[model samples]
Target: MKSSYFTTLIQLLLLGAKNPIKLSTSDLAISIDKTQQTASMHLLFLEKNNMIARYKIDGDDVIQISASGLKYLLSVNQKIQSAFDDNSSTLVTGKVFSGLGEGAYYISLSGYKKQFISKLGYEPYPGTLNLKLSSNLHKQFIENLSNVDGIIIEGFTDKKRTYGNVICYPSIIDSNIQGSVILIERTHHDSSVVELISPTFLRKKLKLKDGDEVKVNISV
Candidate 1:
């Protein structure tokens, strides 16, 4: 996607009263300082790719970013942020948290486990270690990690149901263990809460407990 597209998306998100904003090509063009034709073309592409929802209300264009679109924009934002933090390695600090007991089951699924081994270099232990970000900076870094384009665990479907895609970032847990921070495509946790997967149980190896502060060092 072009920078203009992101600019327009940010414009809409900031200026619109609701999730979607209603506007014409000329209106969008004026907002982004682009030609009307260019604005229309970008809007069309966004609509076709399921990024923005577009329709005609008596000949006017109504546009809003879909769920996928929001996710993509988030990834783009993270990339831009990473560019500014281009110094040494990034260290994210957080506190340990208990999850809903779903991580193990999902990680154990054959569809995901197979790829975890091949792409992540280890078959993750059945469970994931959950951490809650302790600071605004750490939370921002976590979001950037998701956008870094590390090993991708693609979503899959079997006889039961469809699973969402997951993005991983190679990370050093507690300054020793090698693992990856796993961001599930569909997660019940908020952005501040991060999940990590490793070949061994992190809780036991690191002697972690709820509220314990932990740091993950990630190389961008």
Candidate 2:
């Protein structure tokens, strides 16, 4: 989507949000600093795309954004936030935990492993090391990270099933081991649990066990 479209949609949502009643095109134009004709054109496009609804109330054309419009606006806000998050790093603490044995099956898949090798510059171990965030501050970092774009490992289809996309951020574990915070698109784990994969066996090398505290520094 063009940045201009998002700008207009955001302005519209803001104006509509102030009141439950729909907004007049002239009022929207004034709020967004655009001419009425230009605002009407933008609103028409939004309505056509199902982002907003237009109706005649009291013989006047009024508009309000739809639920989809709000979602798109939120996505735009995230993109703006991500633009400012570049090159910044976040340190988060977590406790080691055993996974449900699904990570190995997906990580071992030829399609996924090949890309992980090519993109990450290493062939990851056939399984992931799972960690549960120990603090709410660290958990907020996860939410912020999800709003931004990370290095993506594209998914591919096999004869059996189609694999989903994966997102990765360069990370330093326990201030020593270099790896990534690997986010699988399709996962049985909850948001509080993070998965990592490295060339080395993290459990043995780091002397980690269930309930052991570890710190991961993720590159934003």
TM-score of each model, in listed order: 0.60, 0.60
TM-score of 2: 0.60
Output the lDDT of residue 58, model 2: 82
List ranges where model 2 is wrong by over 4 Å. Answer: 1-87
lDDT of 2 at 96: 94
Residue-wise C-alpha lDDT for candidate 2, range 68-181, written one tens digit per residue: 877877787798799778548888888999988887898889888888888999988888889999788777778667787788999899899888999999899999898899
lDDT of each: 0.83, 0.83
Please provide, for model 1 over 96-209, each residue's C-alpha lDDT reduced to its tens digit, 9 standing for 90 to 100. Answer: 989889999999999999999999789898999999897998888776677676788999999989999988888888988888888899998877988898888999998898
- 10 residues in a row with least lDDT, candidate 2: 13-22
TM-score, candidate 1, is 0.60
The residue pairs found clashing in candidate 1 are: none
